[model samples]
Target: MKKEDLKKLHSSIEANFKLLEPFRKNRLEVIKEYVGSHFSDHGSEKQLPFNMIRLFVDIFTRRLVANNPSSLVTTKPLRLRPSAATLQLGLNHLIEEIDLQRDLETAVKDALFSVGMVKVGLNHSASVEIGGVLHDVGQPFMNAVELDNFVCDMSVSRWEDMTFIGDRYRVDLEFAQTKMFVGSEDAKKLTATGKAVQDNERHSTKELLEKRTGFDAEEYRPKVELWDLWLPLENKVITIAAGQLTDVVLNEIDWDGPELGPYHQLGMAEVPGSVMPLPPIASHRDLHELVNFTARKIQRQIHRQKEILGVASGGEGDIDRIMNSDDGDVIKLDHPDLVKDFKLGGVDSLNLATMVNFMELFKQMSGNLDSIGGLGPQSDTLGQDKMIADSSSVQVADMAARVTKFTARIVRDLAFYLFEDPLINLPLVKRVPGVEGVEIPVTLTAADREGDFLDYNFDIDPVSMSHKTPGGQLNKLMTVIQQVYAPLRPVFQSQGITLDTSQLIRSLAQYADLPELDGLFISDDGEALLDDQPVGSHERTLDPNTTRTNIRINRPGATNSDRANAFVQGLLGQGNDEQRAVAARATG
Candidate 1:
């Protein structure tokens, strides 16, 4: 048939099927009542036509027997007549009296087959018509709720069930085959040539088996081989071959495959399964390359350790010089210039190296200051542009002093931790080079050096010298020391080191200078002098031993002995003998 004619026929069938859908429930009721009446014995009271009765019987019998319904126990002939009471009630009471002449089963089957036709025509058109016709023969079994339940439980639908239905009904001489060959409109078209009609039926049966069972006798070659095949093959050979060819074509044009070169082979072989390499070494590479990488890593670690130790030991100037070097210029803390040295390395390695470099840079920067309170020369510029900048020199000086004190304390503590027995000891001078060992002679000259002169200059109190010592700077130094060392405890703990601040404080106190206060008094008639003369005298005295008494006392209050003696003599020479006796008692 021409494509246009087939298309027109399909459209008409689809329209009729839509109109028939609304009457399906009514038709089913009529057929059930008609079949029920067949068991009754009166022909005049028949509610349905004889032909309609035969058609209903044929369809129901095929469906029931094909479905193997053990539950339907009765084999009574279906009655076409209604009882007298049914007739007296009304024509409506006789359910089969309604003109339910519409072929609902055929309509539904045609609709399903049309869907199959469209699918097959667009994809594989060789077996389209026959496959379309047989697509929904299983629908009648599905209409039975019990059969539907069984199929649903088995999870088998589609062509598998259709093939089962065909096998069960033995469709060769069935009413379905008869309807397809004699009653169908397509069959009528093929009647122009009798042989063509016969060939069409034979071809239709073969196509049905192939669609439902996936067997193609023509391709399998031997006719005997067809009989040996299973009832339902997994897939037809044509479909499977088409899929395999498509897959091969897709794989051949894929650009991800290796090229025909040694480099391609090497590159493909080295490609790592994981995006990132494993620890110790990740990624696929030669053992020599991995070893070289490890060696470089160790070298870097050693270099960093040396740099850290230099900073800690007051080599800050050296660190500053190195940081300003060309190599250090490229070695940034955020984005290191590893690319300048290593030609091939990941961005991740550069980032990691930058972090390590920055950590070291921060350590060096912090280590340059003696204490946390000690600011860099540029620190004054930090907030100087602000309106409320703290430009007080006195405050800055005080802060600097505190920082010095705190730093001294931390240094003392570090020294004790490093050298003292039992982990820590009392604070003591650790003998830092070039600063604490300088000493100068302290001498006191006599101011009086004459006859009976006292050496008052010989006793310069040592306790008073402490106030002049740097010990007075301790308060400020202690504050700064605490501030600097406060952040060091966590680092020390991580390193398994313990610092004893109490011991450090005690040691600092020992070196700290604290002064004492003293008072002196002098009561002498003779002049006090040094080198046998008074401080004002330039010439030598003529009578160096002529009773030039000089008495100097070292107390708050003193009275001259000559004055006391004169007072006693005056009281002794008072008015009368009785007065003299009283004066003597007072003198005593």
Candidate 2:
């Protein structure tokens, strides 16, 4: 790349960012609202009574990222099924390989508070230790990018619709030399760039840091600012240091990753005719202010004490004794009637009511129910409380759907990386079917994913993503079975596809998050076996003519009597010796 071409590209990016100044201003204001007046230059006397924005944002993030969403990968062709499992296992490994949950929570918080967009990309190491040997490693990553750091045209409404995207960030001078611009002539210019941008506080990153920590963090660690420009049409990515070496190209390479460029922008709310999604904090900023104002007024009233001493004629100094009197102190006034108790008005009942109403209104507006925030039950009756919870779940479901879609896209991108990146060869542990707690190591290499990765469909299991106890998950699964599977069973049978009861049980256990119940029954010689044993273990044979053993089942939500019966059956030699001994000890 020539110096003139680099300068031209730099000017183009600057002009593009200038066009987005209005949106940037709005995002900054929203961030300020979230920070509130708690850290303003004003003295401690004018501190905010309460920060409703922060509270609501916290609630929103907690509700959205309550659980790490799981991905479901499957292919249409039977040949690709194994590949799909490989992809799924790779994703599961990736979740733990990186702190994916923390990154997701950070992204959710970023979307809720700062900007409505998040950047998801692939992070890889040039070399890593694999089996005590140096090898390369790669995996998908997500980050909460500042609005100013993310550069794209605001006219496009979707990331897929955009022609180009760019990410602007700063890296340490040493990192720039070793990792980013390595073996390139541009690496020598990093120090110049760092020195030039050391005192530059024009970027939002510096400004936001100052607003948050009340210090210029830029001086703490000198770094070189760089912009990675991606042109989807040309399948190219260009990197350059932004400040002093803006006309010097650091690195340029052809992009072979996902076609949509590396960044995927996600938001909770969508705006028409624009790419900038509205932050959740931006929607109710005024209501937040109103709530704080009302609470501040109430606090001021509480702090104000007005008590006067009413007296008759010539009693100004006579009440000094009363003024200085202590508990159990005997103070005599010149006249007994001189020191009459006269107390003025204090806090108004109306102000208290207004404050309560504002707080409740804020909760209602943001869909942060009392139960959602763990503030205790809101209604008198249990049924009414459930009804309120159900109503709030509608909004929660909508938000969850949006998050689910966002997570699915990320999974899809990860799948592509797993297919294309040669550095990713993950050894995953796979559970064996019909065997409880049995796992085997499986290796997935680039050779396994040989075809187009886009052929396989990737999605997030919403039930898995939701924060639910085992019992709640069981109830949800029961509802799905009763409402969906039961009715469709006949249709499936009509198509000569009989339900596999064992597989069904396995799926139920998986969805209920009860891994202990996985592979509860293993079949052998045309007979279903329990605990890898013959039917005789339960005092019954495989003979159809013989009477079956009477087994008591203790399902979820079972009555105490049912549980007791199951326990007694176990004690009466219905289970293995180990189980019987445990049951005997429990009974004792």
Candidate 3:
């Protein structure tokens, strides 16, 4: 790089910092205050226990993510018929490869709490997909610590994918820095990045490295982004080898990662906020305060009524003079009629009941009490028919639908990410149906890559059996099992579909809350299951009638491993580490 260009880069970086000053001042600073004052309180005084808003939000989020009957699953974009056995088998294998349930649970909870969440993944090297997570929308622009550092451009008011890319790409750069410290490491191996020049409060990395290592250290700016270094050059085109494009800023380079521009950082299901920008919980705050304040006032009034006192005869502090007798020690009463006891009112007796009614009102506002209320007082003695007639169940179903849609989106995004930079890159075998020994290599054909990887699409849906309710799901499954028991068995057998009773039992165990019942998931074919089989034993099972084939693509003997290559690069430092690992691989 030329000296003039280097100077220009420094000036550009300074100007960008100046542009970010407004966003930091307006939005970021205000959000920090909101989190501190309302959300977090570390002081001696805390809010009342019956903060109904917080409690309801917590309960609602838990119900969505915990022991949920509806969860995310993956399938081919185009629905394949049951007769298309090859594609169905391949798709099932892909779904089994990823931990879709756990990942989506985290994403949903994070989005519900923070109103948004930004998900970023590591390159294919790490078997663990999601590398980092940021729940706070403001933190992504201010204090991001993802694999690569990126600040959201604050020039726009409403956040959208279109606001981030195309002609507006320069807006992101107007706040980005070239010579920036993307992340940090420990002081032992690598030091924190401070100001490049020696200032009053900051020291250079070169100086710190020499002091720690007792050796001279060289310094230079990293112009190219970290992901660019790993790209494999092909026909003069630098093919990206890392994760997706949004992981890096790409402020100085043209984005060549299939035009996948700024993604939806905020995935949410809750109704958006209002008034000084707070969560949906904010709407319930006023009612909670009312209940708290009224209860405290009523308690004080009740204490006053319990006291033994008389209107003092023009005395302010005469309580010490009027000492009463107790424990067989007595003071003679001159005039009993002169002393008086405080009296209570009829309304005072109803204070607690009134407060209880107010709390119920709050519940009604949130639609929590709607089920009982909608059934009407006369209909209380009725049967389960009222459960479907009430508006409460309808509202619950709508909320569940939104959450289910969000979970499906997260799984779909992760599937696309995997297809873009596939971790399982080795060859897999597909069995030839009628042939005894012949096998076909499973690989993406040219048709799969004809549209710049756009055609490699997948469909997703929530894992619910006709209903999102657990009992509803369990009953449905049980009914199907009963229908298939005596009649559908031989019908499926004739069609070469081996109906595994063990699989059905495991599903039954989940709804029954019987974890021990999973042990009984044994095959009727006189063979142990794959999961129950010992680690060292052969997994191959011989069923003369079964023609299904399962194949895995990974390093040799990697079946023992959870997944091959968990790239813990930070553990292996830069210099001589790669060479040593390569040597170890060769000699071992």
Q: Highest TM-score, which number?
A: 2
Whole-model lDDT values for every prediction: 0.25, 0.65, 0.38
- Provide the global lDDT of candidate 2 against the true structure: 0.65
Q: Give lDDT tens digits, candidate 2, residues 517-574.
A: 6446555554543234421243322344556588765322332222333454553446
Q: Candidate 1 — what's its lDDT?
A: 0.25
Ranked candidates (TM-score, high to low): 2, 3, 1
Better lDDT candidate (2, 3) = 2
The sequence of per-residue lDDT tens digits that candidate 3 reaches over residues 394-456 is: 655555576666545444444444345433232346788755569877653222322333434
| Candidate 1 C-alpha RMSD relative to the actual structure | 53.4
Q: How do the predictions measure up, each by TM-score?
A: 0.11, 0.73, 0.46
* Candidate 1 vs candidate 2, lDDT winner: 2
Candidate 1 lDDT over 271-387, as tens digits, reads 243211121111111222333344345456545542121233344445554556684364333322211222332223433333333332332332221112222221223233121
List candidate 3 segments past 4 Å from native. Answer: 1-45, 67-114, 120-161, 165-262, 265-279, 298-305, 309-354, 369-390, 422-457, 463-588
Strongest candidate by lDDT = 2
